[model samples]
Target: MIQLPYPRLNVIFEALRYEALPQQELAQRCDISTRTIRTDISALNDILASYGAQIQHQRGKGYHFDIYDETRFLDIEKQTKKMKSSPRNAKDRMVYLMMRLLSQEEECKLDDLANQWFVSRTSLQADMGEIREQLEQYNLELISKAHCGLRLFGEEQAIRACIAHILFQFKPSDHTFIDVCEYFFPEINQPSLKTDLLELINKNHIKLTDEGLHHLVVYCGVALHRLKQNACIHHVDQPNLSEEAQKTAAELSQTIESLLGAPLPQAEIDYLSIQIAARRVTGVPEIDTQKPTEQLELTQYLLDYVNTHYNYDLRNDEQLKRDLLCHITTMILRVKYQITIPNPLFDHIKRYYPLAYDMTVAAISHWGKHLIPDGEIGYLVMHIGVGLERNFSLEEQLPPKALLVCDSGTSIVRLLESQLIRSLPQLTIEKVESLRDYEELSKVDADFVISTEKVSQKNKPTITVSPIPTSFQLEQVNKLILMNRSHPYMLDKFFDHRYFSVLDEPMTQGEVLKKFSAHFTEDNITPIEFYDSVIERESITSTILGEGIAIPHSLGLLANETKVYTIISPHGVDWGNGKIAHVIFLFAINKDDYEEAMSLYDLFVTFMNGKAVDTILGCHSYDEFQYVAKECWFNRKKDW
Candidate 1:
């Protein structure tokens, strides 16, 4: 049933889009003769018509097409819907598309499919054979009876099994799904799927390679969860689960319980675990309740954090509350997942956090940090982080050691500055440009600048900040630089935490010392000593940020990075009896930069949101990754 990939369709579509072209012209553009152009145009137009759009002839123009761009999309949707019934098509594409939909929807009609595909019933029936073969790779079945036409059958559970195949394709290169899934599926820590998928590849005698299987695992999890709730509601005779799968799920449940400290209902653990494993092992996709639960938790956390930490209660307005929660969720998912930024997602974030958008982009480029949130939330950080982290100083020198530069946001930034200074002796203060003078700043000679969002460039080191950055973001920025709170990358514009709660590790004292000597400063305390000093932090709190990333350093000094050294262990270090792939250890050089460290710490927090560390690990070379650290440090410099 395997068919050669049809590159021709894309070419045909492109060729037909021309206003009108001579046979010779089309041949040049499409590398096809006038004869081929005519053939493909006919094929494209036939399909286009079913979708409510037509590829009309251009007046006197050869190879030209008349099309309604907006309406043409309807054709796409219709074709897409048709494929949903069963992966049956005149061409192989419709067959593949349809099969996926049919598998999801559990039904389709041959006559409708035939009409939509612009093919005779006989020709389409022939094509359905090809579709069946293709589905067989993932154990997909195309069950066709004389009356039934053609439909997808077999275990729906395998949907996740198939989906995990292309999860990375839907993801941006910077974020890795495996890492984020690390948090969601704590039960499968070693990523045993790597082995399982490999075995499946060999057994299926299918085309997808190990790499393909690797991604499919997560994509399947996501898709299965997405569909399990509603898409699969209509299906009959779904697949069954094996006991081996159940046992595995229970083990996973135990793991998550260990990580969360409090045990989730064992029944919930059992159900979710089975669901996750079923989607992987069985040919049927299992349902996922993780996203909904996670979102609910995040909203609650936001409300709590904002009220207690930021002194603002956004819950007063139900609409704003919902909107903001949705906004943040999408942002975190996009960045965490490292998925492309959808236009609407960007528009929404820009609509709500416009000033932070451009700044966040600038910060990423400057820091050489790559952030791919599904929307403009990543952009928002650029707006604020860049304003806060600065290379130079401002006029204000106060405690908690950061300055405020918001234009008209109720002095929240100032209040934050004051509150932070109380705990930190290194705290300093500075003037918001709106309230102070150039001369005054020169007199004070502030070490950094902090602003609510991007406005203009400053002569000194600065950290642009969001009035209320997420707690995760705060943790990352705070740990990167200790100066004030500046995300210097943004005018310079926009920018970007901590695992104070790291799990226990059993590293040898000597091993710890070597980590220090090779990477740490010559200061009296060695890395091993620091590890020992903070080892208690692990027991008290868990520091495993999602994405196979962990950060462990002296509790009091973890956020300060006056002097710096970093390590990237792709293999992941053992923490809390769990394996972590990317762990960042930081030490600050100056006593003064400590207050500025919050933003640096917050950077990690921001990244931990979804799939940050995994994306970081995907980087192939040192040159590709160093800027993230540079951006973090510069962005973390405080404003005061």
Candidate 2:
């Protein structure tokens, strides 16, 4: 039998067992990237082919398993279960060892552990080295007693964090803490605990995601179990709580005590307060009038930084101020206690709100004293990004203009122009006339021309459509209009010969960034602050845009003019996010050149989204790069 290598194969198969799963859904359910999931489906189909079955991926519908031979497919599923009985690889061994250490109270003998994996003691010892390194990251230790063998030793909260990490890594997204604990340690599992917890939260008016609720259950379960074993937590820093929050925490502590048949110490109660404070709990308890001076100072610093740098005034935005205060208050507690919360929207926030992310990075660097993590920075991005977006929306935006050209008469042209105006409310119709009149015009004043006749204009976007447009044609027109409305700036204008480099030598992302930064500074194209900003932005999230391309740029314009520095690595540079890029586009823009910067960026995205990425990377010289850019972009289907 060809056993599946993936431990999460069942997660995919079970999802596709009933209905088709969209690529996004599969990605979320598996907690893996969609790119990885797409690749896995292809691999899965190869395996299923032997069983006379295949996984069909329809763009709109998603992946569905089509099994020709039910018995063979069933056999494959059964084989997956048998493979699960024994750890197959290092990753599996690590997870299994962690589970063993966490679920059991007593020390694990090397002999028993070796027997469990059918490995010699020497082999198990080697594996334990890696396990020790992994545990250290969570501030947990693998301790060996003279007579008792090995056991995990850490603060109760840290150990629980390890358990939560393992649970999240191996299971489907929907599995609750109860589900995981029941599977691994049925003796301590409480099925009704989730329901009781929900009731208590509802009664206290505490708001948390289902995932957060599950997390609380695991924390409570582990604390209860450890308390029973007399392994209670100690010296936990007391979290600052509002009067309302304090009341809720007190009620929650009382409820947990009654449910677990265990008594809690003051330190344990405080730890629970920390958990509540760190999470997105609703109905915050009342607090003292005065705020923490340090947090208030930090908030004022953030508001001032935005006003000074970005020219946005948020000093009087009470809601924004209050949100920042709450976040910083909880953040201080988290930093002290080593608590972590995952931001699911981190990537989206970074991608869409580049400016806000930049501002947040600067503020954190200046105020944080080098202590905050990337995850926490993400939360700040949302707040600042939203504030900036709101301010931007208040400003007037110029609508896209379209010059309609038709070979038909005025009567037909008039009707067509009216229809186009009705269909595309966002577009400004500059003129509706014959192609002859358009040619007679010395210059095209509009962004893009919509015509029944084909016009060759390398500079502007053109859409060849029916005089009376169809739905498909309208979609094409809409895409072009939006593209034209976005900055039509090109990177070639800013592409300096001295700034560009073709590196045949193997280089890492950091090395590439360092080389590019030095060139920019030496040439006086930008100051060191620009390069520092670029590196800082990268530290928050990677600049990889997929398809073997990365565009690493700083947050704010740090140059006199927008400039792009190109680096071609025949051997791909790892750009984090499990992506390797052969072409690295590192650039910096001036604050005044933001529009041009956005245009160049949109064009780059267009190139990545099309078949041009491969061709661009294949270019041997700067001339070839320009040639490919013009040919690929202008010649691209006028649909966008």
Candidate 3:
């Protein structure tokens, strides 16, 4: 019997249980493309044919399993269950290999690992390259001896941190504390261990968040495992912990040492204190006297930076101020001591809160002091995201005001006003005037203008509707109301025909960026150093938002003037890692106009939907692109 690949295991199980599953459903479950699912199904049928079973696909339904000889199929299933349970994907294999090396007392041999996993030594060696790259981020390394083999060489604290991060990667959000302990450290008495730790933590009055408590427990368990192998931290830097944190660490150490039946070194105790200090939530003391001056100043600086750069005046938000004061207290320690805390919601936050994440990144980059890791950045983004949401909610609560300009009789105007009020309850009609009166006014003091006649107003948005508005016309009015709430006027000012291009030929990301950069440089819009900074930013993280869309920009505000260079590639450009970019928006933002950055980022996000990207790609001229983009933006206003 052939050993089943890990990716195919789920497909086979679903086939055996259900009569059929749709191709899209299977692809979603496995987190692969429909094309890849089709390929995997073919391979599975080939393997099953030899065992008197095959997978068949229906036109409307999906894949189904058929077995001719029950005995043969049963044998194959048993063989699959008994096969060696090694990791089958590169990511899992690398993680397993790193854990093995970290836990081993002696050097590990590639040959031994290859044989254990049933892979070639060459493949194992290739994975080692990736492992080394990942370890570099944690300040850990792998050293090879001439004859013995390879062993992990790094600070004991760093090794423990790396181990905690690996374990966190495998922890599901719904997992209980004991469930995690059982999976990572099966030999320990998890129930008793957890009870003891909680008792000590409560006894000492050491406050911790739910995630913080989980991290502390996992770290203690990891320390115990390492100590059993005689691998203990001999030296560590002194951490600036509070009196409460120090006492908690002392008691926690005693509990861990009792479980190990040994005394922990003072260095280990100090390291544990640092971990406790980093995770403990400091209470917001009386703001007038107990808060540290330095922390207050830093928090004020961050708030001011956001206000000046992102146009978010959160300086008066007392709740946001207190939350920042509390979070930054521990965050400073984590940065100073190089502590690594895994954020489980990092991916979700980045996906849904791109504007907040970018603003946070820009703010931190402007701080220009310590190098903050992405994990810490994720936490800061959460605080800023809440502030943004609060501002949006307050804006939404205020009913929008509109001026009615109708060229009908007084009775007709009254009827139209009544109809509008019934349809749009949230709208406040500030004034009702005739067309001649509206045209005679020097300025319109309303959010938008609703007219029954063809009227032109450049200052405020104008929408024309029938004397009695239809459903579609009301929808247009509603969309206009939503758009006015956000005031996303940056689209018209930044995107211009002069800066747009349609590239029919294929190009690399580097080639396209450099070409755009050079053009801007010649036009005196950006310095020559702009291209390098953009490349450095891309190296940090790919700008590809997936689905043939990419928004590449510099590390900081590098352009002399703000402009968006739009590119439409009929033939897709390579954006690294098998991603292609059909619609690229290379952002050239200036510091003076940084307040508009959020709106600009939102515009790119609007194009991230597959349909919007396809519509943009179909346009051949700048005028056509502009019209299609505006339609897409208007249609997606509800998402804002």
Best by TM-score: 3
- In terms of lDDT, which candidate is stronger, 1 or 2? 2
For model 2 the local lDDT of residue 380 reads 81
Model 1 lowest lDDT segment of ten: 491-500
Which is better, 1 or 2, measured by TM-score? 2
**Model 1 Cα shift for residue 126 (angstroms):** 37
Model 1 misplaced regions, further than 4 Å? 1-155, 158-161, 164-294, 302-321, 327-514, 517-563, 566-585, 588-595, 598-640
lDDT at 605, model 2: 60
How well does model 1 score by local distance difference test? 0.44
Please provide, for model 1 over 339-432, each residue's C-alpha lDDT reduced to its tens digit, 9 standing for 90 to 100.
2322433433432332234233322233322333323444344323233323222446333434456666557756666544543446456455
What are the Cα lDDT values of the candidates?
0.44, 0.71, 0.77
Looking at candidate 3, the ten consecutive residues that score lowest on lDDT are 172-181
Q: Which candidate is the best by lDDT?
A: 3
Model 3, global lDDT:
0.77
What TM-score, computed on C-alpha atoms, does each candidate reach?
A: 0.25, 0.75, 0.77
